[model samples]
Target: MSKLQEVFKNKSGNVLNVYCTAGYPHLESTLQIIDTLQKNGADIIELGMPYSDPLADGPVIQQSSLVALENGMTIATLFSQLKNLPSSTGDKEAAIILMGYMNPVLQYGFEKFCKDAAEVGVSGLILPDLPEYEYETEYGAIIKKCGLDFIFLVTPETSEERVRRLDLLSSGFLYAVSSSSTTGNEKDFNAVEKYLERLKSLNLKNPILVGFGIKDKETFNTACKYANGAIIGTAYIKALEGAANVEQATKKFLAGILK
Candidate 1:
């Protein structure tokens, strides 16, 4: 099984997936962030590849992306950094998924991107704009051929038929957007309980990880009640905005959710 599959197979509840933009805070901070996250409580690490236009991201994440780009974080640079990461940082048990837009991957050559990601021990990918039909016909085989899982996202507005289709296409875990909005928006879980409950009733083959607006312990716990876990991106980025210490900020922020 792929490393990502192994993670979900062994850990079944409250799987805390943390998202961090590559080269953020500083250009050389990628591996350090990953190491700290692994040593902390992050069950899955979604490494964001800096992009010029990130449609699905909120202001916080978009700003971080800009800073990361200013730090000279390119797809090529990220791959080079990943390739040279210490063995300790590429822990066999920890699953790392590269989250980015298709433009960069296409620029770097999709097949080559997959090959490099596999070589660097990346377990999966989360391309927000990669359509289901396009992936199945054009890129799914290439991704799976490189032994990488391709995760898909689903929003509240998604039809039941589409959700199931996405669940089947997704290999790691299905990213369930709490609402039909960009990341980092404030969410009241009580209002979305029925939507979450409806997803639970679908009995998708892949595990569900609710994202968007899940910022703290209360939201995290509520998300976990309806799915396998939760993903924290904008909130974590907000925590790291100007913090003197990235590791300390990561530790404290994660503690608030997993504690």
Candidate 2:
């Protein structure tokens, strides 16, 4: 089984997937961040590839991406760093999923991107702008050939038919956007609860992980109520914003959520 599949197999719920921008805070910080998150409490590391234009991200993530790009973070640099990185933290292996826009990846060459990602122990990908049709016809085959999962996102506005279609296309897990907005925005748990209820009732093939606005213990608990887990990005970034020690900040931030 894939590392992501193993995570679900071992833990039926409360899977904590954390997102971190590559090269954020400093150019040499990517690997350190990955190690810190995995060693602390994150079950999955959704590493964001800095892009000039990231429409799906919020201001916090956007700013991080800008800093990462300014720090000279690139797909090649990230691959080089991940090459020496271990996949497992002792017995449990944390799944690594790259989150980014399609433009930068296409520039890096789609085939080469998948090949390098697989070689570097990447478990999956999340490219929000990749259309379903293009994926099924072109990119999806490349990803599958490299033995990597591709996750799809669905929002509250998505029709049941569309949600099921996305769920069918997704692997590892389906990322359910808590609301129909960009990342880091506030969420209405009442509406989110009802929406998650609908998703639960659909019985999707892959497990569900709610993203966007899941910032702390209370929100994480609420998100995990009906889904397998939740994804936290902005909050974690905020924790690391001005911290003197990234690892310590990561440990404390994760402890607050999973505590």
Instruction: Please tell me which predicted candidate would have the highest TM-score against the true structure.
Output: 2
lDDT of each: 0.91, 0.92
Question: Residue-wise lDDT of candidate 1 within 1-259, one digit each (tens)?
Answer: 8888888898888998999999998999898888888887888999999999999999999999999999999988888898877786345446889999999999999999999999998999999999988998999999999999999999989999999999999998999999889889886778877899999999999999999989999999999999999999999999999999998988898888888
- Model 1: how far residue 194 lies from native, Å: 1.2
Worst 10 residues of 1 by lDDT: 85-94
Clashing pairs in 2: none
How would you encode candidate 2's per-residue C-alpha lDDT over 143-196 as one tens digit per residue? 999999999999999999999999998889999999998999995777789999
Candidate 2 Cα errors over 4 Å, as ranges: 87-91
Candidate 2 vs. true structure, TM-score? 0.98
